[model samples]
Target: MAEQNKHLYYIDELSDYKISDGYPDVRGWDVKDIDNRVIGKVDNLLVNKEAERVVYLDVEVDKSIIDAKYDPYGRPVQTEVREFVNKDGENHIIIPIGLVDLNEDSNYVYTDIIDHRTFSETKRYRKGGNINRAYENQVLGSYQRRRTGSADSRDLDVFKDEIRLREIIREEIRRYHHDIDKDVTYGTLETHDASRPRVDDDVLIEDEIELSQRRSNDEVYDDDNFYKRREFDDKRFKKRTPGL
Candidate 1:
């Protein structure tokens, strides 16, 4: 007697997946064997737009038991298959939509139907596909590793040189301002007081006093000449002398 296979419905058949509503929640799914042996948990859903339903699932199986041959959506690609086998040492498998049954409350799929040959064939196809293209699709290609060592040192040196030159220029500017401040203070003391004698007037008085002292110290004078006596005894001499 042939064994009776269990019937499964597509995602669109569910009442919540009608035209007015959004996608059905398939978070509750468990990968199992024909005897209902639990394999893995359903990690994601793969929706098919043409069919208006979910056609595949992303099952997280044990890495020791199976290799990852396809993307999370079950699309087969080469680089993933190569890495999965060489690094993980397991084969990738596929579970068809028809074989799975959804459990709404548990948010899981339970199924006893699985196509082993089809799953193996899909893995072979992915292995034969272009690895470079597969890697490009799964990874962000634009990001690069940070440069280090010699290249980083060169950049730091350039920055330090710029900072040193800026500091030198700032010091020269500060010294120029300081010299201007000292000259302004000296000029203010010499010119701002009207009661105090002017610098030029004080200099002239000092010169006249020295000349009178020099003439008084000289003894070569005509004692008999009244004009000579008047010249020596004039009011100008009294003004020039310190006691007068």
Candidate 2:
């Protein structure tokens, strides 16, 4: 989730910096793809206070398929979602700060680094030891591998890749169980809309910043939604040598 730098806080929470002269708070901006197709709306930003930089734009992505001519950004170009056969569920993707494109409009953020599949498959963001350094390395490293192909990356087979992904998520669940505070945690196996905001021109918006949003239910964990812990037999999930 934006590579947990030691310094992370809402803009107003920290007094170390001020909004630079020309930039706008991009919290509720529309995130679009290269073709100017609507992908999702910006929810909040993860700021790396140490760097005085924005590290990520949390976006809620639309995954339902529609009938259109190569609308790669997942917008229903021609027909509404109901007009076409169903596709898939939605996701809240963390668009890396480096990947965003800022234009003069100041009301939108753009990115062409990926498509719907990548955004949907990537794990949702949560704070804590839930995100491991190695996993983050593998995740961020995947962008490059996704570009050039993956002969040197984990070097794992397709089956192993699935296993690795599951393990990564498993570790996160375990860590959430241990943490005193978890901004977001696994609530149910059901398709859940992670707490994200929506705003448009019609509504008068507040310029407030939210570090994280919790799912509505008070109970963050449900045994029915979780699986029995199993051993991965690999040392990487246990040891610190890295390279899973």
**What tens digits encode model 2's per-residue C-alpha lDDT throughout 37-118?**
7777776655554446555565665443122222223223466553222233324445556555655335677655544444
The C-alpha stretches of model 1 lying farther than 4 A from their native spots are 1-24, 67-94, 103-107, 115-244
lDDT of 2: 0.42
Candidate 2: 10-residue stretch with minimal lDDT: 207-216
Candidate 1's residue-wise lDDT over 99-191, tens digit each?
Answer: 455544555555533322223223321221221222221211110111213224533454455468456644554455446443323234544
| Model 2 misplaced regions, further than 4 Å | 1-7, 63-91, 126-139, 145-244
Question: Model 1 — TM-score against the truth?
Answer: 0.29
The global C-alpha lDDT for each of the candidates, from Candidate 1 onward, is 0.36, 0.42
- TM-score, predicted candidate 2 vs. hidden true structure: 0.40
Per-prediction RMSD in angstroms?
A: 46.8, 18.7
Q: How many angstroms is residue 72 displaced in model 2 relative to the true structure, after the best TM-score fit?
A: 18
Alpha carbon RMSD to native, model 2: 18.7
